[model samples]
Target: MTEDMKMDTVVALLRDQPDPINVLYAVSLMGLTKGLWKVSGAGSAGVTRAFGEDIWRLIKIGSTLLKADQDTSNPQKAMEFYDSYLIGRFNVADSMDYDVTDDSIEITVKNCRAHHYTDYLEENDVPRSVGCPLALGCAAMMEEVTGDPFIVDSIESKDGNSKIVLKKF
Candidate 1:
């Protein structure tokens, strides 16, 4: 089978599985992204960016399967829901705190997997930010939940923690 066909089959299978299984697979997929970053050399940033876009696309697909039930009209509630969703769905961080306002969302994540993954990339001479897929994931989910577009304004990481800021667009 071709690569596209193989990926389609895998995605179909994943979509059919339980949430816990899908979360495990999603975490494993991060290792694949790391390996891709290592080999892409100067194109590592593009590869990482593509991975982030793919994450958004994948979440869009998953959201269709599991529609959100909460009333996420409030900006604060939407941001809080996205925070819990990230932790529950992808195990991206050990814990997350959010500061949400009318036009912005600031999140501080502790023990973030994306930070550690980017640290590995940095060690390999690839200078990539710590929030590629994580930032995109948040933006995509927030947009889906709140019906408002968001852009990643900033991402900073230190000592296994990351602070990401997303602005409404």
Candidate 2:
């Protein structure tokens, strides 16, 4: 099929879905990650790490644009907002559980759409630690809410769930 026809077909298929925008978003992120890996001639881990770093740098703009009216200064409140944002606005995950501490946020993402890309990378021998969008998004949200730079301390996936730890510095 022609490219336009192919896109039209995909769109038509997605139109009946509950959250078509999320599917598109997930596909775009996967394409971008794959493209960056190919064009940069970088290892999968390197590509994903760089992608995460870029997300960290750029996410402030997204956080600002998506900011809610409530005060999220408290870490617990911030996490609550992040959870709602992930399920409601981002539409990237089925659910999320978070634990907030003095300087860290541990987030478990259930049924994240980006797990497909992470699995693809792993099938090609990439490490599971390769960052996923959900991980980066959580770290970014924490940094934005706390007004402190938060780094992805660790990320692991198993059985369609991803656990991410963001540590403030």
Candidate 3:
């Protein structure tokens, strides 16, 4: 299965069920835990593509539901839903880690090879989470767990590892 297809399946399932625990478990089973190996084995989008798509979908759906509740003057219900279904089901690290299924995110390599790449997004002066998109999201998740602000802002221009530095509002 292609990674995008896999992601679409998961998203559809979640949208249908709306059960957070089951959603989390189902995500794990969808080869999210399998990481790069899974991508190379069965998915065509690679690890980054699959993981990024899944997380983005999850966030989009969750935000959509919350917004609907908010515009209806029932933010409490939405907040409660998030608290029970989302927050209670996964930790900050797990939430973000659960998002990205990259072997490199958790893998430890023995041999080292160095290649230099330019960092166009010079995240200086302004504080931004460090490392891969998932890792950075993980840090923001940690903040949320600790009752801190959701730190990492999702760059609309730069969602994943798309070597670009477009302005993100």
TM-score of each model, in listed order: 0.56, 0.62, 0.25
Q: Which 10-residue window in model 3 sums to the lowest lDDT? A: 111-120
lDDT of 2 at 141: 62
Cα error, residue 40 of model 3, in Å, equals 3.1
User: What do the candidate models score in CA lDDT, each in turn?
Assistant: 0.63, 0.65, 0.31
Kindly list the per-residue Cα lDDT of model 2 for residues 66-116, writing each as its tens digit: 674444678898678656665776666899998997599888888775666
Error at 33, model 1, angstroms: 7.2
* Model 3 accuracy (lDDT, Cα): 0.31
How far is 104's C-alpha from truth in model 3 (Å)?
17
User: What's model 2's TM-score?
Assistant: 0.62
Task: Give candidate 3's TM-score.
Answer: 0.25
Q: Please say which candidate is ahead in TM-score: 1 or 2.
A: 2
Hey, what RMSD does candidate 1 come out at?
9.6
Residue 20 of model 1, lDDT score? 71
Ranking by lDDT: 2, 1, 3
Looking at model 2, residue 163 earns an lDDT score of 85
Residue ranges of candidate 2 with Cα displaced over 4 Å: 1-28, 38-69, 125-131
Clashing pairs in 1: none
Instruction: Identify the leading candidate in terms of lDDT.
Output: 2
Q: Which stretches in model 1 have alpha-carbon errors above 4 Å?
A: 1-50, 53-70, 123-131, 143-149
